[model samples]
Target: MDIWKLGAIIWLFKSHVEGRAGIGKFLTSFVDNERKPTTVVFHGICWNNSVKLHVMKELSKAGIRSSQSMSKRTSLIDHTVLLLADLNCTGTDELIINASCIAQATQRELHRLPYRWLVLSDAPRSGRSSLWDPFLVDSELVLATVDGAGYTMTEVYKPSPTSPAILTPRGTFQHVLTDTRPHRELFRRRRDLMGVPLTITNTIQESNSSIYHLLQEDSLELEHDLISKNSYTLAKVAFLTLNATPVATFTNSFGYLQNGQWTGVIKELLEYNADIGTNVGMSQSRLKQVMFLDPLDNGRARFIFRQPALSVTANIFSLPFSPDVWIATGLSSFVAGVAYYLSTRLIKTRAEKGTVRDAYLLTMSALSQQGCEVQPRHVSARIVLWVVFTSMMALYAAYGANIVVLLQAPSTSVNSLATLAKSKLALGAADVNYNHFLFRASSDPVRNDIAKRVNSDKGPKAFYGLTEGVEKIRKGLFAFHSVVEPVYRQIDRTFQEKEKCDLMELDYIGYAAFHVPGSKKSPYLELLRVTFKRLREVGIKSAVNFRFEARRPSCKESIAMFSSVGITEMRPVLIFMAYGVALSVAVTAAELLVFHANRYRLRQRRVAVQLGRI
Candidate 1:
């Protein structure tokens, strides 16, 4: 038999001979009678049938569920305690390989490893060359080791990469095989690290360029991107509260799944190179690989632009009156024109010899409050003209008053995503990784149409930098989709106070927050969460955000400033005048052609008569 097997046999014999409950008394203390018993999973090559059977019987007596193998579908609640049956047979190298395999299986099944360990051998000591580095590095766990005679208990955790796992002795049962000594709490959920060093990874894009570097400056103001600066502040504050010395590492990306492998900060975490990844998004794919802490900021990307002029959404000339009012006005004008023509025929005066065209011209002149050469000779004709002029004066005044307000008003038509997609505004997006993904990958038809408009020419020109995108927003009739905080910072710098009043934003990606991510099964998860929550409650998070995200500029100037009429507002009047000029030119050309045709026909008749006489 192996040394572990021999030791186990001796241990059992001693316990039975001493009339002690052996492993049962220690195991029962971990269970609460009111709740379900804690589960114990045992797996190793060292377990023979007799040894396994004996341990199983003891576990059953303690009211704990003991399993030799773990199912892939096991719940995380079932991962209470993991027992490595015989670790003494394998040296440090063998122990590492075996533990790595077990960790992989546990992570695959529960997405995290167990925090409590029960080892049958005392091979894993707290040393620099310990085999427990891979699993216990930067993590906290309850460790209990048993030899033939007795067992020793300790809480094992590592604070930094340079330091070895610190083992705090809890209890020891050496002389007696087992006793009714109460089991003290193993994992007490510690928050303060007492100024331990930690590796924190983050990304810093420099000079609005794609290249990224580690943050060299300690000051937040020196950072170009507001998001990067804000994240740095929050991370610094939270870690400092926990009394940890953070060693910062900068990567080019937050992390992305590239070629079936994670790159950047995420890779650092998976390889145990980083303890915390700052300024990370809790995207679905990322959550599968890393455990995200509580959200720091509820960030959102949106379509932001200036509100378009009313003329862009509808015909400004027609907006002066409703359809019913316009119809009534047109009918009244036509009736007045016809009435004047009929009155002229009835009166039969010198100025009353009016054609249908003359009657309509006189009607238009009166409606415009202009004088015409034609005069009414009789009472009936005079009465008809007076009535038509009086009614038109009131209608004209109302129309002019409404036109003044319509010219200055902003259009609210493109308020929703559906309307925005149907609007005539030129669309563009910030040239970033996630924006490209969202625009192209969305299955909604409205989102697809918006994507098509942004990629209208099917080229790269539609994507712009933050500076360029904000500039386009200021120029009017252009909408840009981008992250809110960074874009607002540019707006605050470049946009005028009056222009800020017209600025509008529509949500693109819903308001999901970004969080600080750490490696899965990190021992510091709860402590970090508590610190962040406390920071947010104390308004530190808000204070940090204020430095990065520019608040919407005040609209004080909007109340007193006058909007000047632009070419867009004057287009309808220009088109009307052009039509009138074209009509007059066509009439002149027609009259000249008619006069020449008549003269030619008259000359031809005279020549025919002269030839006949000859």
Candidate 2:
């Protein structure tokens, strides 16, 4: 019986050992096949206490071993997972736990497994660092903190892995802590001892499938790390607005609120950085940056950095799309008028009076001698003045003739109407001028006879000798017409030598008219008002009139005239005074006229009633 009992116990022991070895082999094969060796280490911590125990049991049962003791030796796990810490965690715990996990998971024989680590803090705050820190320093591992700590890796860590060892002050741990002349020196030293090159992986689980897969496996910790990194990046965006009131809000990668118009914000962002980064495509970046954030809000918010290529193209093309007639012609006319006025005034005052001494005066006197009065100077200067004027006029006329000869005056050319008539040049076959002349001649026999005599087929015969006599010039044919004072003065320079062909001064028929933009005030309007008043005082009637005369004798002749008899010209000096008077008079006169007419009619009815008493 004793021998049998011993045999049973030995047999059971052998079976248990063999079973454990089989499980170990299976676990090693599974880990090797599923989890490839990579620079990044990921781990998961179950939040439920029961779940944590179950996970540990499962790991042990699978023959995966846990470290027995902490050591400064490089042989250890590079990352770690701490489970079942309470949800209420502090910012410091978050930072420390993340750092420790990163160190443990990265531990290895090869260059200390690259010093990077990650912590899975399933609860809000777990004594993650308190539990993991001991393991981290013992293994001579570098750490990384991942949490909502609102701090960067460089801010909370004493030593950054990027610095040199000589500059780094030796501390109880591998990292350094020191106070150098330059504050950065301490940081630089710490960085050297503890810093490790790290690449951040921001996980994004946008779909339920991805989330389900992550929750099902231990590697789901990767998703959490990605989300943390993504959140951190989003927090860096700046906010701005045009008005004090919030128009709209935009979220950056860090989820910060920016208020303003989208276009404005995008423009500002573009000026800062041309490229946004790798995650967002150019089109998506443009949509995020250029599109309106809060379209329904009163204030608009936008992301400014990226803009559509079409928008840029449209902006460039839109600049030259406005009406610019003012610059092309209106402004030109205004400038030209001002220049001409200034030049004419300067010539009249300086050159004409000074250099051309008495030349103008002589011409005026000559005009007066020919029946147009020289008023205010007749008997006072008489004979002596006449003699000096006459001699000067002759000299001036001779000078003009010499200049004309040198320039080959238009009157001598075939282009001249008078020259063509004398040569009896056949007018162009279908010329309107020829038909018009024939029609006029046929309609008026007396005029036709005169025209025929004057237009005889002769070689350079004078049509009419230069004489101071008024004559009626045919329409579209004759060079001179009835004389009017203003017209005569205007044309005198052109026809001084040929009095018979000179245009005569007739009664003022029309005034120069100008049109201005109906919606806006113009400087020209003011000048026109001033000028019209001066002209009216000189007996120039500017009322609208239409003259109708027969082109042929058989046609009827008629004229219709309409005058602005009630409209008074406004004087420059009395603009304000005149405006007031005109308004009052117009209103008062209308009222008085209506009232008086009514009273008169009433009186007549009353008189008729008294007579009807019989």
* CA lDDT, every model vs. true structure: 0.68, 0.29
Which candidate leads the pack in TM-score? 1
Error of 1 at 278 (Å): 4.4
Root-mean-square deviation of Cα positions for candidate 1 versus the true structure, in angstroms: 7.0
TM-scores of all candidate predictions against the true structure: 0.71, 0.15
Model 1: which ten-residue window has the lowest total lDDT?
179-188
lDDT of 2 by residue, 383-407 (tens): 4345545654664465446533322
List candidate 2 stretches off by more than 4 Å: 1-188, 191-593, 596-602, 605-614
Error of 1 at 434 (Å): 8.1
Q: Number of clashes in every candidate structure?
A: 0, 38
Top candidate when judged by lDDT against the true structure: 1
